[model samples]
Target chain A: EPEVTQTPSHQVTQMGQEVILRCVPISNHLYFYWYRQILGQKVEFLVSFYNNEISEKSEIFDDQFSVERPDGSNFTLKIRSTKLEDSAMYFCASRGGRYNEQFFGPGTRLTVL
Target chain B: TQLLEQSPQFLSIQEGENLTVYCNSSSVFSSLQWYRQEPGEGPVLLVTVVTGGEVKKLKRLTFQFGDARKDSSLHITAAQPGDTGLYLCAEARRGGATNKLIFGTGTLLAVQP
Candidate 1:
């Protein structure tokens, strides 16, 4: 089965540095999203992108965060200035067809020190 | 913002035992989806419940959407050790032509052999 895939499975970065997480959603899927889960906490929505623009974003998706569909096949999330609280597992998801379920990537674990 | 609360943050059960996990929300959702996530991985979609009073089953797992569309449940019959994972429920929050998921608190289950 086709699955969402993310690169750099684990990343360790210092605070105030920039980090970019990459994801390749399933081919032919349109809607895309970025979410984060602090260890042992709920998965929190950061932003959603469609039609080359942001569709929805939560408070967590502040100026420090940005998402881009850099190309037809790659979606990227960039953290301009990482903070200690930014340490978390970031997941990328895509939905297609009826939009009943959103497929997720393996996730990029970001650890900020 | 919609918040989904899950019961029994952690559960450890013996193999072949049956258990139910829950997802509740104060706001209504057009659809609720259940996902299973293993350590170091993103969540995998398990089921989606769209209509009120809807029930859907997949193999040993059964899912139900409450009549009010504000809650859902997952019941596993004779669960095996392979059923161990963190379970999360989510729904797309309506926004300007975009759909983004808001997830539940999550339930971690460990089925012991």
Candidate 2:
């Protein structure tokens, strides 16, 4: 079955550096989303995108965070300047037009030191 | 904000045992989903329940949505060591153009052989 895939399974960056987490959702899925989970914490919604625009975002999705669909298949989340608290597992998900079931990618582990 | 609370944050059981994980919330949900995740991997979709009081079974796993749509439960029968992982319950984004999933804190299960 087709699945969502992410690049750079793991990343390490300095506290003030930038990082970009990339994901390629299922080929035909229309809606895309980004979520994060701190160690021993619940997964929190970051943002959602459709029609190449951000549909909604949570409070945690502040100015430092941005998402882009650079091409048909690639969706990316960029943190301009990482913070120690930004260390977590970032996941990307997508859902097709049919049902509400959203498929998730393997996730990108972001480590900020 | 929607908050989903999962009961029994951690569970350890022997092989061939049965267990149930509960997800509860004060806010009613339009749909709920169950996912399983390994240590370093993204969540894998197990099932989605839409209607209130709906029940769906996947092999040895049984999923039920509460009649009020504010709770759900996942029951695993004859669980094996392979069932060890983090189980998450999520509610779909309500009244929005996007379908972001609001996830619970998650339950970590370790099935010993």
lDDT of 2 by residue, B55-81 (tens): 999999999999999999999999999
**Clash count per candidate:** 0, 0
Query: For candidate 2, what is the recovered fraction of reference interface contacts?
Result: 0.89
Give lDDT tens digits, candidate 2, residues A30-78.
8999999898888888999999999999999999999999999999999
Candidate 1 C-alpha lDDT tens digits along B1-113: 56799988999999999999999999888988899999989999988889999999999999999999988999999999999999999887778777788888899999999
Clashing pairs in 2: none
Task: Count clashing pairs, candidate 1.
Answer: 0
Residue-wise lDDT of candidate 1 within A17-74, one digit each (tens)?
A: 9999999998998889899999988888898888999988988899999999988999
RMSD of each: 1.3, 1.3
* Residue-level lDDT for B65 in candidate 2: 96
Please give the lDDT score at residue A96 for candidate 2: 73
